[model samples]
Target chain A: MEPRSSGLVVLVLVCPLAAAVLLQLFGRLDRRLCMPTALAACLASLSLTGVLAGNVARGMPWVYHPGNWGGLGIELKMDLLALLFCLLIAGLASLVLVYSYRFIPHELAPRETSYYTVFLFLVSGLLGLSIAGDLLTFWIFMEVMALSAYVLIAIIDVPHAFESSLRYLFMGALSSLAILLGVVLLYGAAGTLNMAGVLGVVRAGANGQATLALALCSVGFCVKGAQVPVHFWLPGAHSAAVTPISAMHSGLVAKLGFYGFARFIFFVFGTTAAVGVLKMTSVLQWIGALSILYGGIMAILEDDLKLMLAYSTISHIGFMLLGISLLSPAGLTGALFHLLDDGLAKACLFLCAGIFIYRDGTRSIQQLKGIALRTPLTAAAFTLAAFSLVGIPPTSGFVAKWYLVLGTLQARRPFFAAVMIIGAMLAAVYAFRVVFYMFFAPERSGALQMDDVPPAMLAPAAILGAGTWVLGIAAIWILPHIQRFVASLVS
Target chain B: MSQALSYFNLTVAFTVFIAGVYMVATEHNLLRKLMGINLCGAGVLLLAILTGFVRRGQQLADGTVAGTNTVVPAMQWLAVAGIVAITAITAVGLALARSHKRVFGTMDLDEKRNGVKQAPPQSTPNATEDRR
Candidate 1:
């Protein structure tokens, strides 16, 4: 069992990494093998995550220590929550891999080698990040994730990709510095870097040093999370990447920031220290509120399809953070649920957007009229995803919004509830505008017949799009289990 | 001597940090910003090293005075840090060179944006109606 658990952890990580190397090797031998090889590797990791999730669910949180250092080894600790997030990371990457089968050669061409390689590196980094049990390893894996993301964005061979990737790299470095300093400060205060040890110190009413560490960590994570003032780099970076890369960045990578933030801030620092001593919860609440309004307004004003989706990522993640900041059980559950919901919904939307661009070779929304007539299934997926984004009933977006509203009311911040409602309305405005124009608006005269993307791409989009409804209905059962998890975590 | 070394590290770390912040905030030059980031990273690494020092009398499990008596080599940590930093810097540097050479047709660090760049015609079709 020991060998198996450790092997499972290493396998979960090494699968994608090995595939990255093999994909490069295979691509050199036969270009056609790249997609299948990449998909197989991602699927292997996904299946491993399922096993890890099962072990965690059976009340045995697997902790694999490579060196078996008595108490201080860098450990891959997978609690139920971490396993849940790992499932998301692995599942999302596998789908993106499927989505990229036909999309990559069409877009990346000769550069497909670097494209798939860096993408697998990113997936490995994200999986490693999901189970990070200490600050040192967390920072290491986080940089792995960030550096690969920078490379992914830059290698897309477009002028915009160049500028945006450079800007993103600089901003990313700043966030890393913040996180490093925070970790150093925390270790200084607590004399240990272990998550559980840090939690012990924080819960014992940590001194000024610990509070400062928390502050630095929040700033760093917020910037990486693309919370408003530091969020300028995100729209540029997300929109400029190729669409599949955009999905990975928006749907997967940004969630890393939130994961580290929650693991440290709430679970380690303890919410009371953050709220009472640091007076941070309210500050974060304000940041969340600002991001929601700002992201919504900007998204509504954007004309490019990918740009609109990029801004929507900002707005939806804002909703997640807002739920977290409420400091209520429902809020945390809602935040976690929204993490899964928004990630899949946005991925589906971006893939559908990619199909549109693939077919017409245009990204401007004005030129995308009557797309529903062109490809009914893809359009239907886009519309479902759009409705999910807008919080329509029986969709995951609605569930997230409902829980968040309840969280605010329970927190006795009725004003915050109002802000969320307003944000949702703004979301509906932008999302429905795209939907209306694409499906309802008249097609320009002389519109050529357009076909849906190949089943390779459409399968992933349809699955994720349908995931919008499945996850919403699933949330009713899922939230209570998440509540139990959050309850245990906070206690 | 140890006290002086600590003070020296503090002063240099902070000086570098501030200088980096100033460079990043005020300068539009891409090279300057990159330099700022490197400076900031140096300050941070230095600070981490500073935090590693054991106090004057804190001893090891074997009862020998720690850190003060003799240095415990952090070779592994340094090596790991070195590799990560070098990889990141190399990647970014190559990208900078590629961008400059590809776009401007020169290695000059100065941006050559003319007044025409200010108006910034929307290169993609119909992408620029909204100002908000």
Candidate 2:
């Protein structure tokens, strides 16, 4: 990275933080400026990311060590993968900020100012994590994300929201501790905090300390990912939060876990198949497989619309984890592609679910029946999203699933291939359950009585719904970029 | 005895972490759970200090070398970062517990869940006026 590009990278990471601070100051003067100010910051971030992506398109990653003290301070690395995620987060966040204009209740006026501040702050954390070049910076940004999420969940101020937010706090604290412990161990083994430096050190040779560090790190990340025992917190957290938040949590926050996992395994560890480390990748595969089946089964049983999407998120996370663990080029590419694919689809799905709740004032799956006749556009948007989630052809979801299945075959894991197919089948079962109820179930309560939600809400969902296919159609170009990214990171 | 002395800090840190996890697992009190989380953070904080402790390159009295030391002052910064994180988390956790207590009149999670207290007053009555 040249000086100019590196400087822009810093701005890209700092823009949201700057906007957040500005919002806080202006919040005292007028409360109405919060949304536009946040949106402006997102625009700045998106443009800055465009510059950094231009840099990434040129060559290998360039680490920008702030203060130029030879990396003694925080280092920010820019690359194709980081740029992709930054764009997704910033772009979606802008839309969410816009959606909050009419979507957030006017009663929460006093709270809305602080909401935008924290919301922008959260966006800063996500962008920071995307480009963080070292584990300490990574952990700090992860904390930022987790802390803001806790506040956002509780911001709804209902009793159930409080309960769920507190539980999320407990879980977040535990995960942070776990990751901190791992970082300490890694420092002990490799005397360096920078991830690329860790790779260099580990490649030189890893003893028992390196092995223990790997185990500790994986445990921390799995908790963040919400694979099994730790995953029980997600449904409650998602259900208790509002729609825009639920979309952010499901779309971007969950994908960040896979981002961290890929960073550690492919970049920091260098993918060299260290004798003991190979075993960890295999273990990751097993965890992925288990989560696939578990998330599928759980989603099938969920009666709440939001909770079902939450569980479906976990299952798709399983697919990404499975892709990363496979350690094949095709698998890594699939994982990255799917991260984008699922983010768009799920954001659309959750936003449409928000419209359902808004129109019908209920989240129960049964109560949502006959909603389609009432609001055909939202129902249509949702069905399109479902097709994406179920991996129907012409959506990005199918492209990602196709590559994932091929990656599994490449790794010679036919069983996981079967798991992918079976999981998608289960996804079809649950996704269409909503569709059938919305369109086919007879109207009992005369609920087809209102027009669709206001366009402020519908526009974002429609765009994201279109994004799922746009990404799919553009996959021919996008997949090659992802392949190049995986090659650069792993090598 | 020599081996025990050589690995003392690592063992102590690990032990503290286990104890914290045990507290978290066994305790139902919300404050106690927060304390448990603090204990866990303390254990990790100790480990962070140990990452730098070997930089002085001292030999044990039993003559076992304390391993190579690179004089990484960066590790101390890591410890400082950990402390800041703990402080923020502690503030948030206390705030949450205070809210929990006001709502339920007790610190037990099970009691809160089982409806031992009155349901919270609704924020917007007409928002859900029609829904069952």
Candidate 3:
């Protein structure tokens, strides 16, 4: 029965990937037909993943035995946490693909089919990363997602776009190398790259050298996750990509780092007090706080709107890291909640930015004055998402922040709690800076006249905005579920 | 004395990482900066691999695989694969640099930024604009 379920998991991931290959080959023959076919594949996989996640959340871990002839090879393990993240990945992919149907035509009409085909493959890679229980498989999926992104970003016909893609490729490949080395060290130390196997080895007792290896492994993941002090590539790479790609990168892809952290902390190391694991968590906390402050400060100073949003993502992830670092129930819950909220908010902001670029050919905040009057729906959606970014009341962002604050207080880290407040204030500044520029900034006589977003695009943005509201108001309903999931992870 | 030996390795790796970081920070030459990043990565990889070796000869005696286990295997494969991938990336970067060099006749990091030969005038507006 378990083997059958594992087969189902592999099929769920592979079907879209196969579809991606087919779409790429056949895309040029009938450009108009490509989008629907690719979208259908994503939707199908999204549904299957949904069912798998539901089963897992009901306290059944989905384990896929790779092939009937079993060796000590890699297996896909879907615990509740993996299920939640997979759902986020699938959900974000669906929304972004729907949004791109209309948006891509304005940006790249001739290549719309190719764009989405690559996009679906990228989604498959992300889904694979979240669910992969083996280190080697995780690394393979990580590269697939990243390389596809490099292609997608460079697909735009702008000079800066190409240059930025090259920069992203350089940084991404380097970090991947670091991650590889880390994985190797862990494999060497434990003699098996399986998360369960490693945990067993580490749990035996503390060894000075193994502790150092663990630290190295965490650093590699930290680089991949774009944690502070190693986050130089995020802003430039994110802002320079086409907006839809930007949405997927920030909303879904960056969270892989946090997922890696979560897996290592709970599954690989267990909840035991060892010098190495202790240092990693504390370091993660400090880095999270620093990233929050650094990302916020830089975001406030940015003139380019997309760049500002990109930096803001770094800052928000800082808060997410803060929660995870606490290693408490409330902290884990808050982190998970923020993960969901941040994905929705980022998708909204990126889509809003896409609309701006679509209607009027600019992303300069200064040039976007009076945009609210012209595109009221998009303006409203943007405003809602911005408030969510600031963790304003009645938004899930608020719920996430509230839980985090409480968790920090319970952890007796008042100073860190103060830092969270300051980060929130900075979020207000950066988010409202965009709002003020769009609505209240004095209108120029020749601002580009733009139309309201088409229903295709508007629909997804609306759903995301509603999600923010749901996560904020009904948070208690979902909070305990994530807590139980985290408990399962730690124990 | 063992502490000194470890510190010495740490100092060397730290110096390489710092130098790599500095080149990444200041150098505009894409390939040069990439080399710097590689240097930094190498430093860190050395530190990690060295630590993996340190646990060797510790008297566990239980026949349990220690340093030669899962982490090391994955790291080794990852390292080999990483080098191969980075080399491919460098090749592409070089091709891009050569193309730019052909147009501008120089690939000096600063010159690549400052010097822009005028783009050939577009033959078709919609054709050019549609690509965006």
Interface RMSD of each: 6.4, 6.4, 5.6
1 or 3: which has the higher TM-score? 1
Per-prediction DockQ, in order?
0.24, 0.34, 0.19
Candidate that scores best on TM-score? 2
Give the Å shift of residue A238 in candidate 2. 1.0
Best of the candidates, lDDT? 2
Q: Write the per-residue lDDT of candidate 3 for residues A1-491, one digit (tens) a residue.
A: 13225577887678679889888778767777776877787788778887776667667788886753233347788877777787788788888888888888888776677688879878888878777877767877887787777778766656566566666766676667556655655565576667778778878877543565566667766766677888877887788888888999889777777777777777777657332445667878899999989999998899888998889888888888888888777788888888989999988898888888888889888788877778777888888888888899999999989889887987788888899999999999988988887788776444454456689888788788777887687887777778787776544
Error of 3 at A450 (Å): 10
Among residues 3 or more apart in sequence or in different chains, the pairs in candidate 2 whose N, CA or C atoms overlap within 3 Å are: none
Evaluation by lDDT, superior candidate among 2 and 3: 2
Q: Where is the poorest 10-residue window by lDDT in model 3 chain B? A: B121-130
What lDDT does each candidate get? 0.78, 0.81, 0.74
How displaced is residue A332 in candidate 3, in Å? Answer: 1.1
Q: For model 3, state the Cα shift of residue B79 in Å.
A: 7.4
> Which stretches of candidate 2 lie above 4 Å from their native place?
A1-5, A71-73, A273-275, A444-450, B1-6, B54-71, B113-132
Tens-place lDDT per residue, model 2, A169-248, is 88778878887887887777777788877888887775555676677777777877788756877888887898889999
Candidate achieving the largest DockQ: 2
